[model samples]
Target: MNLFGKFATVGGATLLSRVFGFGREMMMASALGVGPVADAFNLAFRFPNLFRRLFAEGAFNAAFIPLFARSLESDGEGGAKRFASEIFSTLFVVLTTLTVLAMIFMPTLVRTIIAPGLAVCVDTVDTGRQAISCETRFDLTVTLSRIMFPYLACMSLMAMVSGILNAFRRFFAAAVAPTLLNIILIAVLLYAHWVGADTVTIGHLMSWGVLAAGVSQLALVVAAMRLAGFSVALGVPRWTQNLKRLLILAGPAALIGGITQINLFVGQAIASFKPGAVSILQYADRPYQLPLGMVGVAIGVVLLPELARALKAGHLREAQHTQNRSLEFALFLTLPAAVALFLIPEPIIRVIYERGAFDPTATPAVASVLGLYALGLPAFVLIKVFSPGFFAREDTKTPMRATLVSAVANTVLSFVLFQFYAEQGIALATTLAGWLNAGLLFLGLWRRGLWEIDRALVKRGALVLLASLAMGALLLVELHLLSDWLVPAAGLHRQLAALAFLVASAMAVYFACTVLFGAVDRSMLMKLAKGRRGRAKAAE
Candidate 1:
């Protein structure tokens, strides 16, 4: 399949996953809200999730996919399969050992790394009343982290399998697997509500649910691998030459990934000092993540292998074309999303999360943070687009160095901003850090002559931004006109109707402006569609 076809397959599945994830977060808000339990749970979950990104999704894939694709190209199917097996065995052993160690030292991890603020007791009153009134529970955080830490092991292995599948252009399974996680979590929340379980019990069950979902995700991807006519067997760890080279490359990539996650970790850790700050930020983050996952992640996952294959075959022009189009595609989707988030954050957050345990008072703070995060959305997506320029060429150290600078900037900025803006300041710090990272990546690529923005891409990006601004202007007016109907107390049906109308209007305006302004190339889209159809027919 062509690049656009692969993107469609992956993006569509990711869109589904994001929708389910939205539902999960909505339920979580009603169940836990921005309460002590919610804060603790978010803290606990962030620990393992951070490592999952570090090992499985970010660094491991960046390092492994290129090498795996090269093995497939140079040594044929058998060589690639053997290589995958060895990597899988090694990753399984390492992740299992790490998970065990993390579980054993969960307290220290929480005290030093996750939530140091929870160590001191405070006479804070429960404002939200979603859970028992208490200070942040350090012991509870540790317990939940230990329960959920195993998820990192399961998901790391699953990510390795996903990288193998992605290398083969089988994007559907890997993209769809995350939806299963949201589904399981939603189901657990529903069950917990049905049984009238307290927030703490619900939290514990949800942590276990994360582990269960990991197993299911791993099983699904393994089934997909099998269906693709590849059997990846588990074996004793081997220190083959290729494996050693992969480790060497992955070391820097892992640091890069860790640095990238540290941006969020810093924000979360600082937010933990205030009761419900973590959950509030989490709720606000969910909306922006939808666009990020749909556009940024889809491009990142599909672009890497495409660029790797092209570069390996000495097809520099094709690789550059792939990179430029990926950027165009990312901006086409992300610009409008960022505009919407920045323009209508309060309405969006209120409509989605300000019900049940999530009180009205929390909406403004979350909305403010969402707006700040909107400023960074483009940078985040750009990072995903540009980083592959380095990774596809097997130069992980450059991005790692860039990330170190960004990470340090984020830490310092968060600390400075927290004293004034509180959680919003932390959110702003993250945004500034994202731009710094993206800028550094762009400069590095330019210096190396690896990527260049052509005239067409620049024109299209400019038009996309203009169209997004136009859409945002329209949304602001429409929202103001529908202010009365948009309130949460106006009844769910009415509020939803107003929100739906505003969203549809914004989308319509954005698409019309882009098409009329020639931002989107009609013929190119038609050609891609036609190519996809022809390929489907040939396969049939």
Candidate 2:
């Protein structure tokens, strides 16, 4: 398989999902605003995603794929199919039991996850000088969380199907599943407005939308898996060797690779102390995810199975090359995206989010968090790309250590920053932890002699950095020139037009310089354009 080709198809689909996500969030911002409804929805939405990332996306995939690859390589097609069927049967029952427990005890879970925020509304705060009531904020969060917590059950089923589909090296269905969530939310929000619903009603409708999204996503991937020459038979099951291997891998991978989600959980816990903190963080985090999910994660997902296949065949060199290429691509694209986020967050936020209930006050606040997140974007993407090396080797223990350290770093930083910066402080903590996570991963890889940087790669990376810096400078200048145009007292049409101009200009500068300087060579471009599955080679 040509690694790059697969990423393109999968990444392109993921990009469409992100675009739909932007639309969904846009509607969310307008309908719910950055107040109680927004905070409640964000708090409710994040935990399931937290577990999804922890259990299903990273750790589970890390363990499952190599085993599935082995089944395919050693035991043939029949063996691989049997392995997948057992995994499906086992995961379905386990996740169903867990979800039922979670749903039944969701209120306690909500309070535990956002204890500080809930405490504010549920308790009275005392100071020597003053006392304040926090009942409104606390009650709002608890109420919102209750409405949306069932999303976990839906996503778990989807995540299992996602894993099975991905194990078959069919990424399109799984990669595209998330877009449905975005689409469903958008549809719900629009429907609420069409019928002239109030904010509370809209929030309630959107909560149901979340559950519906999970079902839609699960169905989409299950169908895609069937089309890709796989069918998961649901039934009573026993734990096979493949299942055991998955548990062993997923357990450590979950602890290690779940740092990012855990960091968000901690941040939300802190944000719960202040009104609207969670909501602002969610808005800022959305734009950041666009690049991370579409490109960074797409590359990682596509490369995992490829790396496993190569390793099973004792093709270490191919595996190494694959890792190198994956890092380069992730860094090259993510660096520019980081630059864009850091350089122009305010305008981007204003254009997309500053309307209806989302006021101008929210723009700089959300933008500030987005800027901090940009500092770690490259590291965040690199984590996805590099961890597969350890995962494909069935080494999940190393990343787990790094995950804990990063999580601790994030927690400490959140408290330290929140002393004054408030919600942005929590975001900064996460940003710093991401950098820490990336640094530790690179160090571990080097210690094991698993990663090395070629001088050519170093030279090219430097050039990309310089080119992106130049692009950032250009964007800053343009933004200043059009500051009047961008941050204006106007309708949505005018604001959106300026945003379009800004994005186009940034794209022009970044791509133009990369191509002009031959920093992105044609072959590399062709490979990226083709994705990880190299039908390009076959075509040639």
Give the best candidate by lDDT.
Answer: 1
Q: Write the per-residue lDDT of candidate 1 for residues 325-443, one digit (tens) a residue.
A: 99999999999999999988988888898888888898999999999999999998898888889888899888989988999899999999999999999999999999999999999
Please provide, for model 2 over 1-540, each residue's C-alpha lDDT reduced to its tens digit, 9 standing for 90 to 100. 467668877888889988998998888888777776677667877877777566545456777667777787789888888887888788778777876777677667766765556653655543112333466445555566666665666665566667667876677777777888888888888788899887656767887787777777777877887788777677787967777877888788776666777888899888877767888988888899889878876876787788877888898787777887787778679998999999888888988888777877778899999998888888888888878878888888888888778988899999999998998889889988988988898899989988777665676777788889988998888888877777657566777887788788888888888887766767777766665356567778
| Candidate 1 wrongly placed segments (more than 4 Å) | 55-58, 124-136, 257-260, 528-540
lDDT of 2: 0.77
Q: Give the Å error, residue 207, model 1.
A: 0.8
Alpha-carbon lDDT, every model: 0.87, 0.77
